[model samples]
Structures are given as C-alpha cells and as structure tokens.
Target: MLLGAERGAGCYAARVLAKRIIPCLDVHNGRTTRGQQFGRAEHGELRDVGDPVALALRYDEGGADELVFYDITATAEGRGAMLDIITQVAERCFMPLTVGGGVRTLADFRALFLAGADKVSINSGAVANPEVVRAAAEHYGSQAVVFSIDAKKRPDASGWEVYVAGGRKATGLDLLEWAVRGQELGAGEIVLNSIDADGMKTGYDLEATRAVARAVDIPVIASGGAGNALHMRDVLLYGEADAALAAGIFHSGQTTVGEVKRLLAAAGVHVRLVQHATLGW
Candidate 1:
C-alpha cells in the first residue's frame, strides 16, 4: 500500500512509495562493528558486535526489507569485496543485499553479483574515474549500481563535502552536485551517508538529505543517523528520503526491523510489514 508523508508538510496528496528499512553491517576485520561517527578500533571506540552472517540472519528474520554489508576497512586495506561472507549470508537470508567497499572495477561488480549481491556501491572508485559507475550501469543495468557518498558538513556549516576512503579522505566534491552527476551517469540509487552523523542517533541530517533527494531522480537512501522509529518517520516525510539505514541501534539490540515497521505503520508511513497468522496485527 502507498502512503503519504506528513500531510501538514504539504504532501497531503502525494503518493509516497513504501519506505524501505535497511540494516547496515559495518564489518571490520571480518566482524561486524559499531562506532560513533566513524571512530576506529584503535581509538578505543569501535566495538565488535557479532558475526556479520549471524547479524544478517537476525535482520532477515526480524523483517528487514533489505540488508547492506560494508567491509568498512576494505578500501583502506586495499582488498576486494567479502565474497565468502556475502555468499554465506545470501544463502541463508532471503532479502536483497547491497555490498560496498573495495569495489573499484567491473570485475568487482561481476564478482559481487556472482557472490549474491543484488547491488554494488562505489565511492572512491567513482570519484577517481566516474566511468566505472557508467560502465557498470551499462553492463549490469542501472538498478544494480548505487553511488554511495560519504559526506561531512563543511567546517563553516556552509555545505557538505564528499569524503572517501571510509570517511578518511576529503574529495572537495559538493554533495548535491555529485549526486546529480551520479544520476546523470545512470546510477540507480544514491546512498547519502553523513559522516558527521555516522553513528549518532539523535536524528538524521534532514536538511542535507532532502537536498540530495530533491536533486536526484533516483531513490535516495539516507544513512547515518536513525535513533528511533520517529527519526525514520521524520527523514522520510521531511527529509524526503526513500529509505533509512541504521547500524548501532539495531546491532546493539535497541530495536528490530519489525518493531520499527510497526511503529511506522501506526504513524501512517507505508512500509512492508511481515504477516503473522497466529499473532495478527
């Protein structure tokens, strides 16, 4: 069923698509980890939550619409996508999977697709040579290529600038401009991740997210700051994001996909809720 955003926000008659709930697994050294705003393990902040495959199974059974797995350190470590783990998770979980990090060429996309990734996200590689995204889109169809941008608000709070290498390198690319360019290059989606809000759950960067969503025709997945179901609601209605991605909250057992969807449905946000015959909603 289609739903409308906050009618008071001027979307009273707008037909909003069913919002997606995507759980992201930031795997570091083969273990799923969580940290505040891109904190590393060496800084005594990043904490290993559990096995990636185990968590994937949990989200899959908990009613997640999709799952995203990022080998957080893959780019920094100069490696390829985690094919073995991805294959393991894909074999067990029925949800679509989006894999990012260490994806640099057509070979990477081919390997990921063969390994069971429904979509491949590219960042630094796209910056270095946007043709990678264009070529991948042409070869695998636009729906399989997602241009993921890691952005941090400028020091003066003027605008967000793109970052790469796991939010460690600055690219000086304006977020909105890059998003539009990505869409022009045939990207199927834009995963706009806010570096400043990476793990802080107060709420999403609504203002920034809306700008990107309005600037691109492709679906925009807002990443980095979802504390509760209400936050997800705000981002979709006010931020205009097609989906919201969260990590620490779900990984720390704060909430499950079912609980979030239940709350969202109660608030009039359209989402795919799992059915139950014994315990009907």
Candidate 2:
C-alpha cells in the first residue's frame, strides 16, 4: 500500500512523486461548456469557446502539465466526431492528452491512440462490458488505458456506487470492488470522479476518493469538486490521489496552472513548476 503523506513527502521519494494538475475541456456540439454541481448527469451552460485546437494551445501555453478533452455529447449522440478534435489538438499541443467519451471498443481506443492521444479514458463503455478494460490493456498497454468511474455517495448504502451513461444510469457495483477489478485487469490509472462533489467546488470528495485510491495500485486521479488551489492540494495530499483533474475553475479564468503550482508549493505539495508565456489575458 502507498503511504499517504503531507504535501512534500512524495516529491523527493524517487517515485516521481510530483502531483499532476490536469485541466479538463468539456466539448459539446464542438464547443466548450462549464457544467454545474459535479458535471455529471446534467447539461452544462455552453459557451461558444471558438475551436478546441485554439483552447488546447492556450492551456499548453498556460503551463498545464496535461490536458483532458471529454466529448460530453459523443456517447449520447452515438458518434465519434471527437476524434477529429482530438487529432487537431494532439497535432498542435506538445503535451500529453487524454481523450474520453464514446470510446466503447478496442477499435475506438486504437483510433484515439493513432490520432496522437497519449491515453484513452473509458467510462460508459467499460461499465457496459467490464472485459473492455482487459482487452484495452492487452492491445494498448496498461498505461494507455484509463478507467474513469463516476460515482456518487449512496446514503442508504454503505459505500459509493458507480454511475454510467454519463452518470444517468446507476450500477450497483461497489466502488472499491470496481476499482480493484480495474487494477487487476491491468489498468494503468484510475480516474475516480465524485458525482456528488462535482462542480460543487467544495473540494474533492476526499472520503470517496481515498477509498478508491486505497484499493488500487496504479495512479489514481481525483476528479470533481475543485474550486481553488487549496482544494487541489487537499485532494492530492489528503485524498492520496496521484493527480487532481478539474474543469470549471480553470475554464472561466478563475485559476491558472502557474497559480495553482505556487499555491501547492506554499502548502508543501510537490508539483512541476513551469514558466510559460501567458495567453488570453
């Protein structure tokens, strides 16, 4: 089991202990949008934020360590147009990219990887067929396959439950069990998104996140409920996540990667501090 630490322990542990700051871009109908209250199972307030390629370039310039592009409508729409956007962004942005949404088969994963995505995140598809995780890991290697679980706390139940179809459908699978299964199937990373905490910006659902993190051996990314730099730090340090992914706070110019790093440094969390030219301001 990985020992949970304060802000600074992991940075010098020879384990590449730096926490990742990932900014998520939710594209719907080819436009950027900000969803409210967990960004799950609901439509967001859409913004015609020009082209994805342009925004991706801006984030790259703004010192983002990594980028996540989620085609918010792809699964519902039953198409793969997000691949075009992923290709466009990957060609222009010189950083790692993780593309999610509408990825159901090995072919879907292959297409995204071929399009230059460093990783592919699958949520709904993996729920529909758990074996998808094993097949993806076999074909693309474990590191390239990311299992994204959107979960919400069940007051009546003892633990959180996984939600599928963009959080509209609930699966009775226990959160920890699913997480362990994904790891056993050779998943390189686990993105545990808290449906209850998403978009609320109260900070990440540390309890739920910690449960999953403790269950998995690979890197775990805590998503949902990131409002400020402190929230990011809290999640990384307290939740024991390898990374924290957020959308709204960064999208509306409420925070920048540089600022987030500075805050993390003050809190003693180890993060990559980069100097870059500012954009869009």
lDDT of each: 0.84, 0.79
Model 1 regions more than 4 Å off: 1-16, 276-281
The candidate scoring highest on TM-score is 1
lDDT of 1 by residue, 54-150 (tens): 9998888787878899988788779887899988987788777889999999889888888878788999889988999999988777877889999
Error of 2 at 113 (Å): 1.0
Return the lDDT, model 1, position 281: 49
Residue 49 error, candidate 2, Å: 5.1
- Model 2's TM-score against the true structure: 0.89
**Per-model TM-score on C-alpha atoms:** 0.92, 0.89
Question: What tens digits encode model 2's per-residue C-alpha lDDT throughout 1-281?
Answer: 21111111323233336888999888877777766643533443455555677778878888777788888767766878477787788767766788899999888887887777878899888888879889988866777778999898899868999987777778898899999988988778899988888778899999988888888888899999999988999989889999889887887778887788888888888888776545322
lDDT value, residue 107 of candidate 1: 88
Query: Which residue pairs show collisions in model 1?
Result: none
Off by over 4 Å in 2: 1-16, 38-50, 277-281
